[model samples]
Target: MSWTKKVLRINLTAGTCSPEPLNMEWVEQFLGQRGLATKYLTEEVPPTTDALSPENTMYMITGPLTGTMASTAGRYSVVTKSPLTGAVACSNSGGFFGNEMKCAGWDMVILEGKSPSPVYISINDDKAEILPADEIWGKSVWEADEWLHTKHQDPQLRVAAIGVSGEKGVLYSAIMNDLHRAAGRSGVGTVMGSKNVKAVVIRGSKGVDVQDPKAFFDATNAGKKILAENPVTGEGLPALGTQVLMNVINEMGAMPTNNWKDSVFEGASKISGEAMLEPRDSDGKANLTRNGACFACTIACQRVSTIDPEHFSVQNRDDLHPSYHANSGGLEYEAAWALGSDTGVDDIDALTYAQFVCNEQGLDPISLGSTIAAAMEMYEEGFITKEDTDGIELNFGNAEAMIKCTELVALGEGFGAELGQGSSRFCAKHGHPELSMTVRGQEFPAYDPRGIQGMGLGFATSNRGACHLRGYTVASEVLGIPIKTDPLETEGKAGLQIAFQNATAAFDSAGICIFTSFAWSLEDVAPQLNAACEGEWTPERLGEIGERIWNLERLYNDAAGQGASADKLPPRLTEEAVKTGPAAGKVNGLATMLPEYYAERGWSPEGDVTADTKARLGL
Candidate 1:
């Protein structure tokens, strides 16, 4: 069997840690990571439990392909009820943590109950303990990481931790790992903090083994070859990182700007990936430093960037980490858009500074920046005053305000507290919930739904919340991957969204980066999974597993009270027309698409997975 067939269960309330054999029956059906973890969660925790209560559980899981030589194999997921949306939350992340868990001979770690005092989990191979974490309780992720390494006296320990934002209960707080990558969105880190768990430090020298070594190697090697030869995976991503889409999307007039009041940014070129490579007049250096890779990923699409040393945001801050002075995970497209274009701030240096704060504070930059943008719009429209904003001019394109607000949100002080609650709560508090560019209490990503009809349906139906990664139709709508579809057309989009959503679920559960799907399909993934696990994992079987996992999460959300009513976008998206660009006079066709999408998925018109559908999937 591919699974070490083991799970580590930690009850911080009782201060007890135990290891149990994995359920082979579940493994045979659920696969792993997102799918298998959800099965465990659905079985153990009641769907109606408070997301932040001790009764709720968190699962950090890896798939069978994790820790292997498969392309983009280093991935893990944090699964829990989201404090932000009260929906089933599964935030996938990449770094060294998943590989470490696999190397430690465990497929998953289940955290239950609350710790009375601050604590951190330290796993050294088979030994796991909840150690006192008082020293790093209120520190930033960077600070906590350093303290953990010093306390452990091990340079190789991989640490995933929260920061001040999480400790302060920022509704979109993220769980940051490797100092940069994160299980970002839906307040997973807030839930972690509510449990008084500060960090998870792990070290493992052991490696993972699969069911069929030779077949595994062969399958993984072939998958890698496919990725290496694909244009999007091998060339575009490596050359420009995710930010490559900035200019393209902007040119298409689909880049959401100024809290979605506009569909295009006036300064898009200034913040595009191409702009990052241009030498700045200030120091004759480009903003982009280099590209990076997660553990074992041959395709290094991660951007490593540096703000101008003399920029106003970092000027005279000599005490900053050396990595900040140089380069780290830079502005991916989503971050750049949300923190840059969405806020009407095209200053790349300023956006980079905000990105750095998100990494350090463990906040979802998308939610944080989008909420701030909404506040900016509110301020400009006289809906809010200086008294509400602590005298800061919360105006669009105010780079200084953007930088200051990011710092305040990182510390969860002043207006930042309101912004920390996320756009849904922030906008509702000010009597302008319609202004919030969100769906199901989660902020929208870069794409303007009016410009890309498929994404509108995808965002509306996403199980967790409005998110791009849930079902990225931009690949087909914009990049012409697999097939080209008219971005403005509502027809055929229902089947498209369902297909993308199901395929993405499979990738998310497989312990590999979904970016690999730019080239590799389920057919490519099936061989590796079959070689690693004891099962007849064909491409068709993988597709079915994906559908089953999607239905399971939908059921959990339905029971959690986020039912069909939540499958919707804000009124602004459906009523307000895009005033300019190619999508001018166009509004999100959600009304026309939702019913069609439900029909295509075998879900009821109310968006519930039908009993017949469940029986068909054996869920």
Candidate 2:
């Protein structure tokens, strides 16, 4: 009964939007959101298909718990082939959009073929239309969002849109929703732009219903209690947001400073969560104004922040968006690390300004900042000249240079186009492939593989490229959610990584935030699903489903030729030793862990899903 059993198929080339029945059989096997959408992608698009081509299909999907009272249930995923990695991409986001989509009675929206001109999909309950978007096509996400709302005069409308970065073919463009929240990794927005789809606006009046109302209430309320009691999900996240990790990771010697040449940053504390709360000298205001929540989210980890108006980045800037002048989406840990630490900038206001620009213009800050870091390395090495950077001095620790690169990339102009292709391509072009700290063409987040041993293996074997969300060993290795593990020791990390990977797949598929995993396990999740969904949902069954999903994504990547060979860390991580603190003189033990990981998963030594494993999962 939780299943809407509806699909919206939009063919941009033919200018057709048709309704189709959801495959009930697939739904039973794969569940919903990431898992269900992947099943559609595998059937429709071939492994060899060009990610930016019309042949590569895109799925905008909601899970079974979506539009429900489940905590963090507003999450949705943009599933497609990534233009940056040429691998399957599923980028999740939270805001009001997913709930609206489900309320409109659609479980998924599939896009195929390219439009002759720029267009947007607007849905109001059963009514849906494709409208010309010429006026807003090249605008920033903020500009486009405002234009759409004013044009339609629907104050309640929820919009997910791209910006000039997406429209201009920036490979790492994001799909921004709620003006700030994003499906922010792996270039999902690039694929959207390739199809000439600029935005999707939705408004739904039909409310969501579950199978067992009384049991659903009991299950959900119990889950909320667990979150409230847990320290990480309750106090830590709510008080500091994700920026809390800035000082913690730095102290651990895993901060990945100056493009990962060092393990620690000298200026970590100045850009930390605690610092965000400290009153600034100018107007005595803190960078963080307040905490916020997505639909039904009680944790309220979302940060609302204002840049120091007197800071050089924003001072006297006449072209700044109104959001920059006031509180907006603040810097998360990854964005702060990439823009500040990795580039050696360390100016808090500059990082905040860059983050706002990223949201406004639909760019992935991880890729954007990491790419510029690589460019800075090249400039310092004299591999490239100031002429190549369009007269801007591309130097590490120069906040002005960092800000300039950000603005240029948002517009996809001049030197920005080169940087927009991501660090892998940029480094390769400059004959320094070793300089790009990436796995499968996607930039790694803040954690250094050398310090956090399991994370290295996690990044290497991650199906979606160097992503923490896919499987966060950090919970155990660092925060010790379920149990504490040695962050330096590689003894049991293979098993640790596998467990996290499988469990995370379940969490992601169930339409809940992985942050909830800090307190709630699948055992906690099973009661809610068993009541809300039609079938029996034991922890055992959910575990198997998570494992099945992991294998499915792995098999798809293998078929796409990003096989076992692509499962590797960069040379700099494997060859060079970290220079400071607890992890001094250490390198990642991925080689020692890879074989054990393969054996635990019951895959072949070559890292392909075995016939026996496939039969066991009934794949």
**Whole-model lDDT per candidate:** 0.90, 0.92
Question: Residue-wise lDDT of candidate 1 within 241-300, one digit each (tens)?
Answer: 999999999999898999999998999999999999999888899999889999889888
Cα deviation of 232, candidate 2, in Å:
1.2
Across 212-233, the per-residue lDDT of candidate 2 in tens digits comes to 9999999999999999998988
Candidate 2: minimum summed lDDT over ten consecutive residues — where?
Answer: 24-33
Where does model 1 exceed 4 Å of error? none
TM-score for each predicted model, relative to the true structure:
0.99, 0.99
Model 1 lDDT-worst window of ten = 319-328
Steric clashes per prediction = 0, 0
* TM-score computed on alpha carbons, candidate 2: 0.99
- How accurate locally is residue 153 in candidate 2, as Cα lDDT from 0 to 100? 99
